[model samples]
Target: MPPLSMPSIPQSAEPAASRHAAPVAKNRRGLETRERVLAVTRGLISAHGYAEVTLDQISAEAGVAKSSLLWHFGSKEMLLAEAATSLFRQIGEELGAEPHHGRTAARRLENSFDRVADYLTANPEAKGVVLALLFSGSVPASVREEIRRGWDSHVQDLVAALSAPGRPLPAPMARLMIATIHGCYCHWYASDRSEPIAAFLAPARELFADWLRSRDR
Candidate 1:
């Protein structure tokens, strides 16, 4: 997959003459405004899928002029792309914060699930946007590809965490584990966050533990 695109303003969007001119520095307030716009975009997109969201809605909610969004992000596509990129980066950071620790692979795997549950609890918007993008047919191909890459990265991380000295965990098994966790998240979100995500993950955790024991025997 291609490297995830960074959220830089496109130079091509600038006037021809201004393209070669020195870039003007943004003041603290200007930076704050840009961040505020991004925050609003993420929240809206998370609450409502990408296709359902519009520049006008984002502008109104963000309290910035529509023209200002164009000035900062160049276009709606760029803004959404940047927002998706930012969300993926945040997920990666949160999941990668500490190595999973346990005496056995099964225990380590459980710890990993706990970490995910904690992350989902702290950032429901993140979970909402992720599920929305994954299941939505209306999401752009570029955005879908970004989500795929992010998902693949998490799968690889789990594979590594579950692997042992002479016993490497199969990628498929790792994917199943991820899918199970995502299923838990899906149920939790579908229920309007009525139950904790950890509650939904409990059965899968037990099932995995049993599977690991069978493999050991």
Candidate 2:
């Protein structure tokens, strides 16, 4: 009774597989749900504009519970911003990854532009989301950084391509060229064309040349 000692219980190690099994399954399910929500959210926002898309609509279109979407993304504004950020990243990757082909470097650059044109034509929302975010300025700071990072990567690819054997393109020139291509897509979109989008590629190189000459000053 003068001194009572308590016994210590040793911890036991459970099987690593057993410990991780449930969590892994849960994580995979969560990721799938999140991706579904994000994809649906981007589609709605791009098609209807950020100001018009709502959480309820996203939930319905994604076939997710509204509560689940709120839990995953917090708010409609946050979801839209995240979606725009994602769309921007996708475009940047496409631009940077477009395969270079043709005998000469200049021809290869033009071929790269061909890929860009195809991408823009196939995914109108890629341009729409960027334009919306640029004009709206409602995207979160973190999302904006993601967008800038993507374009910065794209710039590197363009710079490498443009700085060829005889021709050297400045970073500013690359940026201008990209902007001109974007303008072409915008024009095509504004025209409401039912014809082949590839047709709009006609004057893109000439447009880029005009911009490049003006940039010489």
Candidate 3:
């Protein structure tokens, strides 16, 4: 499999006039304020879960006014959606930055596992935010749909990379691989870093590799 690269989120069609209008570029300060709001949202969601987090808390923690938050993101749901999308995009870019090195497909899969383990280890809060969103029951349907779209994009990329000539991987198998990867991360997180994430993922990695080899045979 090649390096994993996620597809961009699909945007809705804009009005003809809006499409023709010049894009308003944000200044450095505006950009920074936007990022600060996003960062604060992610942190709060990771620590308290999406259902428990409030716009007031984010505004206070980010040192931005509530009106500014609304101005940047329009609504709470949009803010959370953008935050999750940004995290997924960041992960995809980092994964795509380095090429996987291995002699065989199975080995390449293991290499990808290593890369994920390293990334999650470095960005534990990312795992927290993702899992929190996944398990939360109170997320708005619109927000949940956005998250699903981002997740499906990631899964589609992995499935494409893992498929062989004239043989596409089943979407379910791709989902299984992703679930196992997150399961390993959950265990490692629960253990409080007592065990390395790589160790937690090793068995599942080998299992996936074996399954891939079986299909090839």
Candidate 4:
């Protein structure tokens, strides 16, 4: 089958209008170019470490001119910033496995965490980007800040979920859970993900259940 051009992505994935943002293309070909660059970015970054994947390789692999790469993305840093956001948003979509109604807040949180853990296991390239940009001091400071922002939205979403009533979780605890989840993610990937990634999320689920029991008692 022929490749689809510009398939709908989450609204949060839209490229920004500013130079620091993903290239905002207007024309059909222009949009296609951006998609190709992002695909190559994800693929190569997954195969190699984030710092090792360069714009020269992305441009060559995506079949776009080096100048075209620049025309779409002001710099490689900006491209990776956008690609990280894109990958994260894709993971968010993966978390929405079931209908919200009839699901307990703890169950929902568990599912979301499980989804994130599983995603990192499956997409090692994107995981490498997370490790290099967020964990390792390999990227420029400006890019590091951008990568941090990319991680915040989903965490904020998790915080919102934790705040739901009926033994609502405290914000501090929600933040702690998310922080721990990130730590586990680092450990899981660093160890080659030998075991199921969701195994790391079991503690968060247990915590939520413990809180629920306390509230019921």
Cα lDDT tens digits for candidate 2, 128-161 = 6656665566666655565566567667767765
TM-score of each: 0.61, 0.62, 0.66, 0.69
lDDT of 2 at 66: 88
Off by over 4 Å in 4: 1-35, 93-98, 135-138, 165-171, 212-217
Best by lDDT: 3
By summed lDDT, the worst window of 10 consecutive residues in model 2 runs over 208-217
lDDT of every predicted structure (CA atoms): 0.73, 0.67, 0.74, 0.68
For candidate 4, the 10 contiguous residues with the lowest summed lDDT are: 17-26
Best by TM-score: 4
lDDT of each residue in 92-207, candidate 1, tens digit only:
45545655554577777677677777766755656556666666777667666766777787777766666766777888987898788778877888897778889999999989
The residue-level lDDT of candidate 4 at 72 comes to 68
- Estimate candidate 1's alpha-carbon lDDT, on a 0 to 1 scale: 0.73
Off by over 4 Å in 3: 1-65, 72-81, 93-104
lDDT at 43, model 3? 80
Cα lDDT tens digits for candidate 4, 1-217? 9887886787666455544343333466677778778878888877886778888899789998888777767778778777766766765555544566776676776666666766666665564565556555555776777767766766666655544555555657756766777677767677766687777667766776567556645
Model 3, C-alpha of 163: deviation from truth (Å) = 2.3
Cα lDDT tens digits, model 3, 55-119, are: 99999999999997888777787687777567656655554454544445566567678778876
